[model samples]
Target: MESLHGKVVLITGASSGIGRAAAELLSSKGAKIIVNYLSNKKGAIETVQRIQKNGGDAIIIQADVTIKEQVNAMVEQALASFGKIDILINNAAGGIRQSTFMDASEELWEETYRLNINSVLLCSQAVLTHMIPRKEGKIINISSTAARIGGAGESIHYAASKGALNTMTIGMAKELIEYGIIVNGIAPGMVETPFHEKFAPNEDRLSRMSATIPIKRVAQPIEIAETIAFLASDASNYILGEIINVSGGR
Candidate 1:
């Protein structure tokens, strides 16, 4: 990947997991980071501190990405701090628990869509204001393999929401590429993140799922961050409207 030096990156839900990892890694590569979080203020601070300690520039912003006004405000703050945003990581998501379709509530569906797809729309639109005029930028959406497999027994709602995200990624990629903005997505398989602790808390379940994976193991957050870093850099300049699967070959 090309150098990210001087690039200003805004990463949503960056308090922990893949977002945090991406922030730290990209910052290490010389990108100034805006770590956006909803409820995890402490994690956000830690992410910033780690970057700062490593001689990287970073700031934290609190925002509910699902809300348009909040997203706009966050972008404004990022611009105020960094002047411009060169990359936008639409990573803030997760609003559903493990539940079968028969047990899925309407509220679950609504919440999932708002968190996954709506947030992406709001953040991308808000950031585009800065990126389009410059005729250059990167937008990397975080999706999941469940989008293709249809999380039948658990989290079907979340799966559907990510499915919408994948489609939006392609659509936006085609629309924005003409203007020099590259829009792409990453569909990650099971990773040992807080997400599993919240939804699939059963250790046995995780182990079973791990055994089923072709690589016989789940991924780490940094593994996903590496791909994000790739998509965010000039190395992926020719890669557009694509959803790269980093699923251990599952």
Candidate 2:
């Protein structure tokens, strides 16, 4: 594995799930972590405590990544603490609610758009200001396999938003690689995260969903985190403008 020693990583919505797992795993590999969260202060604190307990360096900051001003302030604070941000993981996002195209309201569409794509746009732009000057950085966006499969019937809006993210990842990578910055995305399939608890909730439905995956089971958060770690390291320098599918052959 490539050493992340001394690298400063800022992960958005890191209070729980894949974000938290990525922060912990990266910290174990020697990176200092900036844990960002909008709510769930308790979970964020717990993540930091776990890292500190394991002899890692980390701090927490709360920000609504979808808001430009808040995103700017969050990046400023991270810079103030670490002096330089070597990597940015755009992991803050949600599907909000599940609804078919016919039942999806305008409000739901707009809200999903803001959460899924707007957050990535604001966070990536905010960090580029610093990464550009140094001509070195890595940006990893957490997308979904839904972007490619179009998601289930109840999540058309969410799937559409993620499809946009995939396009943005490619566009940004193409535009930023000349500046020595690498931009990429991870499109994950079914995973055991609170996302399912909040949206699908029914254990039977989740079980059925898991059976459909070629792997015969959903992934763990750490499994996806491993991929994120690889992208953050120099080992992936030759790769860019690509959305890596971490799905178990869905």
Candidate 3:
């Protein structure tokens, strides 16, 4: 494993699931972590505690990434604490539920776009200001398999949002490459996270969904974290503008 010693990583949606797992794994590799959460203050605090207990440095910051001001403030806080940000993990996202285009409300579509796509743009923009000056950075966006394969009977809006993120990642990578900023994305398939609890509340439906993966199992949060860690490390220095799929052979 490439050592991330002394590197500072800022992770959005760090309260739970993949984001939380990434924070813990990266911290273990000797990176100072900034846990950014919108409403899960308790979860963020717990993540920070766990990192500290493991002899890792970390801090929790609350910010709604969809808002530009909040994202800017959150990045400022991270820079103030660590002096510089070496990596940015855009993992914050809104939940998706089954809804046909005709059945989807305007409010739902707008909110989904705001949280999923807008947050990525705002957070990445905030990071670019500081990262460009340093001429080096790593940005990892947590997209979804829905963006690639499309989710059926569910929020097409959510999938659309993630699709936009993929485009943004590619565009930003091309634009920022000269500055030594690597931008990449991960499109995860049916992971076992609190996401199901919010989207598919029915226990039977969740079980059936898990059975669809070719690996015969849902991905663990740690699995995605490990991939993110690899991309953030020096080992992936040659990679740029790539979207890695972490689906268990879906």
Best by TM-score: 2
Error (Å) of candidate 1 at residue 184 is 0.5
* Model 1: lowest-lDDT 10 consecutive positions: 95-104
TM-score of each: 0.98, 0.99, 0.97
Clash count of each predicted structure: 0, 0, 0
For residues 47-106, what per-residue lDDT tens digits would candidate 3 score against the true structure?
999999999999999998988998899999888998999999999997545678888898
Worst 10 residues of 3 by lDDT: 148-157
lDDT of 3 at 50: 95
Candidate 3 wrongly placed segments (more than 4 Å): none
| Residue 238 lDDT in candidate 3 | 93
Reference-based lDDT, each prediction: 0.92, 0.94, 0.90
Relative to the true structure, candidate 1 reaches a TM of 0.98
Q: How do the residues 184-243 of candidate 2 rate in per-residue lDDT, one tens digit apiece?
A: 999999888888778778889888888889989999999999999999998999999889
Comparing 1 and 2 on lDDT, the stronger one: 2
